[model samples]
Target chain A: MEVVIGTIAGILTSVSMIPQLIKVLKEKEVENLSWMMIAVLLTGVSLWVVYGIMREEWPIIISNAFSVMVNITLLIAYFLYKEK
Target chain B: MEVVIGTIAGILTSVSMIPQLIKVLKEKEVENLSWMMIAVLLTGVSLWVVYGIMREEWPIIISNAFSVMVNITLLIAYFLYKEK
Candidate 1:
C-alpha cells in the first residue's frame, strides 16, 4: 500500500512540469511562469540525483533524473518563449 | 554527507514553488501557469503527506504539508488571477 501510494506520489511530482511544458509549447506564453522556480527545481532535482548516486538509491536517482530532464526542457522552453 | 545532501535537496524542492507563488502574488498574471501542473503537484504532495502520516515520519509530513499549503494557495491565486 505504501509502495503504491509512494510510487504514484513520486510519478506525479516527477512529471508535474509536463503540463506547463505543454502549455508553453502550445501557447508560447511564459509571462507568468517563473524562471527562478524552474532554476531552483532544476538545481534541487540535480542534487537529488547526486544524492541518489551517492546513496546508491536507484529509485531516487531514476525519478529525480527524469525530473531533472523535464525541468531542463522546461527551462529551455522558458528561454525560447520569454519575450525579448 | 548523504544526509546533508538529502536535506538540501529536500529543502530546495519542497519550497521550489515559492518563487512562482511570489511571482503570481505580485504580478497577478497567471496566464502561463498551468492549472494542471499545480493540481498534479498538489495531489502528489498531498499523498506524500498521507504517506508520511502512515509511516509516522515527521519530516516528510511537515515538508509535504507545507507544499500542500503552498500549492493550495497557488491554486486559489490561479483562479483569482487567471484571465477571463
Candidate 2:
C-alpha cells in the first residue's frame, strides 16, 4: 500500500505539468506562466535525478527525470510564446 | 555531499511555485496559467506528505507540507484574480 501510494504520488508530481503544457499548446498563450518557476523546478528535479542516481533509487531517478523533461519543454514554450 | 544536494533539491522543488505565485499576484493575471496543473500538483504533494508521514520521514513531510500550503494559497489567488 505504501509503495502504491508513493508511486502514485511520484507519478502525479512528475506529470503535473502536462495540463499546463496542453493549455499552452492549445491556446498558444504563455503570458501568465513564470519561466522562473520552470527554471527552478528544472534545477530541482535535475538535482533530484542526480541524488537518485547517487542513492541507486530507480523510482526517484525516473520520476524526477521525467519532471526535468516536462519543465524543460514548458520553459521552451514559455520563451516561444511570451510577449516580447 | 549527497545529503547537501538532496536538501537543496528538496528546498527547490518545495518552493518552485513561489515565482509563479509572485507573478500572479503582481500581474493579477491567470489567463495563461492552468488551474489543472496546480490542482494536480497540490494533490500529488499532499499525497507525498501522507507518504512521508507513513514512512516517518521529516524532510519529505516538511517539504511537501510547505508545498501544500503554497499551492493552496496559489489556488485561492487564482480564483480571486481570474476573469470570468
Candidate 3:
C-alpha cells in the first residue's frame, strides 16, 4: 500500500507540469516567466531532493531530480527566448 | 538538518505553483486545461498524501494536501469557465 501510494504521488507530481511544459514549448514565449521565481523554485526542488535522499525514497528523489532538470530547461529556454 | 531541509522543501514546493495558479485565475481561461490531466493529478496527490501519513512526513503531507485543494479548485474553475 505504501509503495502503491508513493507511486501514485510520484506520477501525479511528475505529470502535473505537462500542460505548462507544453505551453512553454508550443508558444515559445517565456518572457512572462520570472527569473526570481525559477531561482526560488530550483532551491526548493533541491531541498526536496535532499528530503528524498534522507528518507531513501526513490519515488520522491527521482521525481524531484527530473523536476530539477525540467525546471532548468525551462529557465534556459526563457532566457534564450526572452530576447527573441 | 533534516527539519531544515524538509522546511525548505515544503516552501519550495508550495510556492512553485504560484505562477501557474496566477495565470489560470487571472486569465480565467482554463479551456486549455484537461480534465483527464486533473483527475490523474488528484489521484497522484492522494497517493502522496497517503505517503506522508505513512511516513509521518508533515512537509510532504501538508504540501500535497494543500496541493489537492488547489488542484480541485482549479479543476472546478476550469469547468466553470469552460461553460462560460
Candidate 4:
C-alpha cells in the first residue's frame, strides 16, 4: 500500500510537466516561463536522484531520473524558443 | 550528507514556483500556462505530501507542503488573472 502510494506519487511528479512541455512546443513562446525555476527544478530533481541512489529506492531513482530528462528537455526548448 | 542533500533538494523544489508565480501575478496573464499541467502538478505534490507522511520524512513533508500551497496559489491566480 505504501509502495502503491509512492508509485502513484512518483508517476504524478514524473509526468507533471508534459502538458506544459507540449504547450511550449506548440506555441514556440516561453517568455512567460522562468529560466531560474527550470534550473532550480533541475537541481532539485538531480539531488532527488542522488538521494534515491543513496537510499537504494528504485522508484525514487526512476521517477527523478525521468524528471531530470523532462526538465532538461524543457530547458532546451525554452532556450530554443527564446532564440526564435 | 544525505540529510543535507535532501534538504537542499527540498528547498529547491519547494520554492521553484515562486518566480513563475510572481510572473503570472504581475502580468495578470495565464494564457501561456497550461491548466492541465498545473492540475497534474497539484495532484503530484499532494501525493508527495501523503507519501512523506507515511515515510515520516519531514523534509519531504515540509517541502511538498509548501509546494502545495504555492501551486494552489498559482492556480487561483491563474484563474483570477485569466478572467481579466
Across B1-84, the per-residue lDDT of candidate 1 in tens digits comes to 998999899999999999999999998889888999999999999999989998999989999999999999999999988755
Please compute the TM-score of chain B alone for each predicted structure, in the order given: 0.97, 0.94, 0.74, 0.89
What does the i-RMS of model 3 come to?
Answer: 3.8
Residue range A1-84, candidate 2, lDDT tens digits? 888889899999999999999999889989888899999999999999999999999999999988888888888888888855
Badly placed stretches (over 4 Å) of model 3 are: A30-40, A53-59, A79-84, B30-40, B53-59, B82-84
Candidates 3 and 4 compared: the better one by TM-score is: 4
Candidates 1 and 2: which is better by TM-score? 1
Better of 1 and 4 by lDDT: 1
Better of 1 and 4 by DockQ: 1
Query: Lowest lDDT 10-mer window, candidate 2 chain B?
Result: B75-84
Let me know the DockQ for model 1: 0.89
Q: Residue A59 of model 4: what lDDT?
A: 78
Q: What is the lDDT of residue A18 in candidate 4?
A: 89
Instruction: Please give, for residues B1-84, the per-residue lDDT of candidate 3 as tens digits.
Output: 887887878777766656655666787776434566567767777788889999998878888898788768767876877788
| DockQ of the candidate models in sequence | 0.89, 0.88, 0.43, 0.74
Candidate 2 ranges with C-alpha deviation above 4 Å: none
Candidate 4: the clashing residue pairs are: none
What TM-score does the predicted chain A of each candidate obtain versus native chain A?
Answer: 0.95, 0.93, 0.75, 0.91
Instruction: Put down candidate 2 lDDT per residue, B1-84, tens digits, no spaces.
Output: 899999999999999999999999899989989999999999999999999999999999999999999999999999998855
